[model samples]
Target: MSWYNTSARQLPWRDPGTDPWAILVCEVMSQQTPIARVLPAWEEWMARWPDPTALAEASPAHVIIAWGTLGYPRRALRLQECAGVVVEKWDGTLPRSREDLLSLPGIGPYTADAIIAFAYRERTTVLDVNVRRVLARIYGEAAPPTSLKAWEVERASHLVPDDGEAASQWNAAIMELGALICTARNPRCEQCPIAPHCAWLKLGKPEAATPRKVQAFEGTHRQARGKVMRVLRTAHAPIGVEELRERSGLPEVRFEPALTTLLADGLAAATPGGIQLPIE
Candidate 1:
């Protein structure tokens, strides 16, 4: 906590006056995306849609365009869907309960806990990849499991402070510690405040029995989809499907499935003229 108080990054959403909606946006944008990349995008997004009402009313085309290079464009649409639900069902106010938050689109366990802890300042185990790694090392595991376990959740829950404010700070501090010091690769243990207490250090830092798998991006269908979406996002008007595919510069095999999935996912639409981003 002491280290976090002085060394935590000055993220805009961490500001004292930031509201729950802004925190929700930050959490969504930060998922699988680096904080550096998310920072500018998040700022522009919040400025464009400061509240649920604003986001709910935003056009799908505008939302996808504003989402820019954030790899998982579907999350952007899900966020808009969440905002719509918040507006229509909750009177434009984010719900305080975990169950209620989980009911919102794109929100899962980690996000729900985060909103509870960071937004509402509640006592909840807010587990993310960083926090999970930090806890795994502290307890002598070389790495966290491929998927979260019941035991992990129970252990993390027990570690939370009883008081809401203290618990929130603990959650933030531990997550920051993991992000900055106890990183997944080449951890800076010498400067870590919890280095003295970390069990993995005492155990000689054994490697994980199974190394994590890294997915390849080049030439993947996902990459092709991104290329297609980029063209559609920048287009002022619909373009013919074949023209759009040629413009994407993807081979026919990659382009066909990419376009099919984009249209199926509702990320793009086929208009009377041609294909473009969803205007609705």
Candidate 2:
């Protein structure tokens, strides 16, 4: 915890007494997006809707527009849904239990655990990509951590302090270390607080035989979806089908699938004219 206080990155979500809604928003936004990109968005979002009731009352279109190029526009829809559920079912309170959090849209195991630990100060394991990487390098006997391994969660839970307050700081510290120092590429081991104890460093940092596969973005359904969303964000009213087709510059075959995904994911709405982000 002391290591983190000295080295912790000053993030808006890390502010004292941060609401669970803000924590949840940060977790969702940070998925697949870098922290640097998510910070300003988190700040702006909290400024606009600091609690579940506020976001629940707002339109999904406004949320999508405010999300602004975070990639994965569906997260905006899921976040809105999550807020609405919190308002309706939980009485505008963010649930501290992991099961309750998991029931919310856009929250998987990692996010649910994070909200419990960081927002509610519960003694729980937070196993995000950064946490996984740090633990893999430090403790993995044979291979780097792949996906969310069951053992990793057990190990992380073991590391958590018995004291709730200290444990919360410990959780945040390890995650912060992973984010700032123990990066995936070009980790600054010399400056790392835990480097001396890292098992990967103890052994040579060997390149894995099978490299991780990168998600292809260009010329894919996701790209087409982004195009459609951009058009909606810029359009003042419901855009006609012809105009959408023209603006997206995507083939009819690709456009249909992308549009279906968008609507299915709650990112867009169909109108008599065509489709648009639900007007707030």
Residue 261, candidate 1: how far off, in angstroms? 0.8
Q: Residue 200 of model 1: what lDDT?
A: 98
Q: For candidate 2, what is the TM-score?
A: 0.94
Over 37-80, each residue of candidate 1 has an lDDT whose tens digit, in order, gives: 99999999998899999999999999999999988999999999
Error of 2 at 21 (Å): 1.7
Off by over 4 Å in 2: 140-143
Q: Model 2: clashing residue pairs?
A: none
- TM-score for each of the candidates: 0.99, 0.94
lDDT at position 96, candidate 2: 86
Winning model by TM-score: 1
* lDDT against true structure, model 2: 0.84
Would you list the clashing residue pairs of candidate 1? none
Candidate 1, position 202, lDDT = 95
